[model samples]
Target: MTGRLSMGSGQPIKLAERRVFSDSFKPLYNEGMSLVERAAEYLDGPGRVEARKLSRMAATLYAAESMRLTTRLMQIASWLLLQRAANSGEMTRDQVASEKSKVRLDTASAPDNAIGWNELPEAFLALVNNSLSLQNLVRLMDEEIYGRNAGMTDMPPPRRSNPVSDQISLLNTAFARG
Candidate 1:
């Protein structure tokens, strides 16, 4: 989970094929849930107070950023829950992966210099930063556990037919051979 998995001889396994059933996944789940709870408590308590003191533009930006933060956390929480379900045997890997596909990992915060961004409390900012870090970790793990893709390169390409073009090409090949 640190970065690589290895065989008994220590040659690294392919990352895309890595599985999430290891004990290592538990720490990630704990950290993710902890962050989600902390973010929620802060937003509902001190964060509300902090937002009230911001200037008009900063307050507006704060509202928007808060929405983004909440949405991001929800997505992270969903992914963590699914991963836990898979780890706990509550759900099969295939079911978890299917549900995981619906969880979005692309949410991002505003630029540091965005309007009123500097006015946000440092604690709130820290939460945002931490959540982003967790999101990235989850995304990497998802790819590793699920295989980066379906490994479809071996499948035959889709056929495209143009009867006239095929006939002309056939004629060309025959004549050229002669």
Candidate 2:
């Protein structure tokens, strides 16, 4: 069934029209995959060299941050793959909805300790920041499309009363005066 909602003007607005998953999903998929590749390359190459040059404590922090970065990217990749399947009709909307529970998008804040943060390679930090930005965007889309609080906005549209029903109620009340 087509996902359509009636507007105040009595016109039906297609949900897909408002946000075509294919249109936005493709770019996100490409960008996400590319970033993942870039991160992997940097971590394995220059990142490894940089980490080895750091002090023991800083090296440990680098390792932890690298793991976190990879985990975050994996989560994003899983979500994107699911969306791609749904968009391509390989999976139904219901299937996608059910599978969504399996994918947890963590929004944990970045490390606050400045002890070894500055010691981290600038490239690694840039990747982390980029991943965070992408994660935020994905979270927003997920909420808009599937969250329990979907369709709710800060300012609601004005309610339209049915004039005919109001008139009928008024007539009924008047005729009952007999």
Off by over 4 Å in 2: 1-20, 107-109, 148-178
lDDT of 1 by residue, 78-147 (tens): 9888877877889998998788777877676666656567998999989988888887767666666675
How well is each residue in 37-68 modelled by candidate 2, as lDDT tens digits? 99999999999998888876556557656766
TM-score of each: 0.75, 0.71
Give the residue spans of candidate 1 off by over 4 A.
Answer: 5-19, 149-178
Residue 91, model 1: lDDT of 97
**Clash pairs for candidate 1:** none
- The per-model lDDT (C-alpha) reads 0.71, 0.68
* Model 1 TM-score (2 dp): 0.75
